[model samples]
Target: MDEKKIAVIGAGIMGISALRRLSENKRFLLTCFERNYDLGGLWVYTDQTENDVYGRKINSAMYSNLQTNLPKQLMQLEGFPMDEKCPSFPTHTDVLAYIRKVADQCDIRKYIKFNTEVQLVTPVSENTQDTKWLVTYGDNRKKNDSQVEVFDAVIVCNGNCSIPNYPMIDNEKEFGGLVIHSIRYRRPELFAGLNVAVLGASHSGMDICHDVSKHAKKVYLCHRGSKLPTFLPANVTEKTSGFKRFTSSSIILDDNDIIQIDAVIYCTGFKYDFSFLPEGILEVGQNGVVCNLYKYILPRQYSTIFFMGLMRLYILFFPYGDHEASYIKAMLEGSVDIPAYKERIEVIDDDSKRPWLYNSHWEWDKELAGIAGNFEPFQSALKKIRDHVLEVKAKDFSKFRLDAFKITGSDSFEIL
Candidate 1:
């Protein structure tokens, strides 16, 4: 078969994983565009004393307490296994290294064009041939700035963290002290000696509150309700026998109706920023991007374009991105038939209302695992999902012990 050209935007974890999988196929001619000099997106470490949009200076590479909410075992790629030397909860640096190692081991770096940002992706199809896409990128290295590339297929793995959402509260303008989005958050020192109020109550919210409470005089973790999972899923252990849970020390609320806070950190989460695309090409949900097909693999009209890492939930038994990539590859290779669904995914009515409010991480794990077709006893389907998670986990664990450790230490591990 003639090599098919493919373009992937963002060299982050999801993008790199997609690229790695695509590279395995000899017929895929792949090119990846990343805006940063390095591969890791949010996982990459930077000095907090450095000037950011929050107008605060980051004094360190990364906050000391930063850790992945998911255990290392669940985060690994299909072939890579975690090394025995590392801890259960791997740090941000450890995850970054693991992703970088995947790029190296898979020989994906040669295909990646770093420090290049994709400005626009336009689909070109008319009365003639098969559909193709024209990808336009901004060249950070060249003075000309405009660079153009085209591909047979485009995979958007940029992720949801690119754009941070700030709530427009009535008194938001009146409050004093520094207010910043979680994207700008690197450490808790900025909240030192001050009362801090945290909003959103997701994994990021929980993480920020946990970190700031250590240094801040007082920290108020405000939320509609806590939806975070207290443990890993039971199916993970029953299926793969590898999964762990990490618990938060404490999360307190304030009396003023708002969490008592001098500074407000909104770990409110992120959305798919596809504003660059034409309206007819894609549609986003109130809470996230809308998808009509099964597991969000196939779009209603755009069959050539696929979305990966759009789901923001516990991914214990199955790695959604890897599975999505596999399905896409099969479609490209003419193997698996794309499944259809009736209802399109919709966003939550109240953006502020936490849908995941009462649910635990373990619950999310079971739900996603079930949806990804991981629990099915069918050998082919089970093997695909199971092997994908295990490969990614093994590769991930080999680089970061914390990931594997989190699964081993979790209460779910004992139950499963």
Candidate 2:
């Protein structure tokens, strides 16, 4: 059997896991491209805001004060364990060190091309049966210099947090405030004594509001009626409706009420974009809902192309990425079979019944990122983790940082 050449698109958490797993197989030759000189992806915090030191717009949303909302146990890669001495909700620096430790222990650093960026990945064949890709990449040191490599498989692990989705609001241009996306958010001190309205009330929004309240005069948490935290800082307030329009001095809500504020921080989430992919090969909307993806791994047209770290946004990313890598490995090694295209469509259709707004899929975006954790006993383990996470959260949202848990077995865990 001939060895397959594989191109890994990012050196983030998912890319690191891919390298750790894929390089173990002698049947695959790998090349990893990382735009940064290091790994850690979105978890890497930088004081440089809105862009890198080179002035390119910054994609990482990590704030200096950020701590892992998920426990250390949930965040670990399958075989890797975070130090038991570390806090359950360790600081961002701790997370980075753990990831680097995994990369070092697995010796996957040798497979990566640091300080390189992948510009494009295009199909070498227009035929549906052919699954070859030409990847064009360049080193950051040299401008206008690049090389194209032909590979039998391409794994895209560049995370989904880079692109900011500046929402379209009516009369937005009329506003005169320092409007910024969550990606540019570094600290809450910037909002000192100012009235700020936070858009999008998910994890990021909630966390940012909690942080900004310490500095801002007041924070109005804007959302479309999701569950609100029982505890918020004294300066924070919740608004149930969404922005209907925006004026230079104020914002109008769906109820025709208006509120004046100094600045607007859009914790409004991100758009998962893969513009480098050739047209018709992978069609994903702004919400990151992809079509023609069989189990969201191989696209219906190509078995050799796989996408990792693109599944459910709310789960533990490291383990899911590992699960995705392992599944693809089994498929490539001929131990698992790719299902029929029609079967793929049916499975995806059956899973799209999840009830939620598809902010990205727009309309077809209601599907859950469920297929990746389907492997048995592992799925059982994930369920236990979810329950444990919810239990700890419900117990004390304020003190979860002190809480800890250890996975005792594949299907079980014990609180530490």
Candidate 3:
């Protein structure tokens, strides 16, 4: 078989993993494009929330003083454990360092084109088996100097967190206070001495509420979810009723009560931005849900194009990337049999909103690893430990970060 020229869209966690695994196969000629000068993607922190040094709007949502939501054990890629001295939930800097170490050790940086942003990706031909992609990319600083290159396959690892999902709130513009998304949020000191309302109670919402509560005069955690941390900060108030409208100096709840607040920080999460890809190929719908993916990895229309790191697999993203990269390698090498177009499309559950495999994520990873023929199944202890961590977090969100656990066996762990 001829060398299969492939173009990877990013140099983030999943991009690095894909480069490492795919490059291992002698039949592949790989080139990875990274817009930023360095790797680490969103894990790379910046104080400038709006724009980068190149004048491009910053897409990374990493903030100062942020720590991993999951323990380090669940964050490691295959065959590479995080630093032993690192805390259970290491800081953002520590995670970035670990990602760099993995890329360096794997020698994947040689294929990277840094400071180059991908502008567009389009199919050169409709023939799935021999399909080629026209990838247009150029220096991040230059606008009209895009260069096009043809590749046998295109792997999208640009990630979903780059685009902030701002939901519509009635009369939101009328709100006199400052409004910002979690992506723009950095230091808690920004909210010092002010009453802030945090919308959404997910991991980011909860963490931001906790951080701001220490400096802000008060924080109102507004969410519709029922399961929330029981032990919230003293200054933090939980509001189950959703936001109805925004007033000039306050917000009106669904029950018609008004709460005075100085500012609002939206923790409503992110959306998928595939502007580079042609329309009709991939459609992003309500709540940022994308459909027509066979397993959230491959698009129903093309076999040569693959989407990596798109699943909402919580803390298992690193392992999931490894499995996906390996599986892609097998599929390209003709070692794994792919289902027909109709069969693939028929198996996908369009009703499922989110791209993630919630409860079946581990099983899905196992299935991918098995198909890859070179990877091992996930450790049984991982799922158990993850479940335990989730349980602890629900009871006391603050305690989960401080608590550590050591894996004792395939299905057990000892608290440290």
Residue-pair clashes per prediction, in order, are 40, 3, 0
Winner of 1 and 3 under TM-score: 3
- Highest TM-score against the true fold, candidate: 3
lDDT of 2 by residue, 1-416 (tens): 58999999998898988888888898899999998878888878888876565545666889988998887776888778899888878888999999999999998888889878888898888546446999999886676869899999899998888888888889988999878889889988999999999998777887788888989998998888865645667888889889899989999988788989989989877777788887787667435576557666777667778898766546566776777787777777776667777787687666454554323322221123233232322344555666666665555455556656776776777767
TM of each candidate vs. truth: 0.73, 0.89, 0.95
When sorted by lDDT, best at the front, the candidate numbers are 3, 2, 1
Candidate 3 lDDT over 49-93, as tens digits, reads: 887777988988988979988888888888899988999989999
Sequence-dependent TM-score of model 1: 0.73
Candidate 3 positional error at 101, Å: 0.5
Report residue 117 deviation for candidate 1 (angstroms).
0.8
Model 1 spans with C-alpha error above 4 angstroms: 48-64, 126-129, 141-144, 226-260, 338-416
Q: Which candidate model has the greater lDDT, 1 or 2?
A: 2
Give the winner by TM-score: 1 or 2. 2
lDDT of 3 at 130: 48
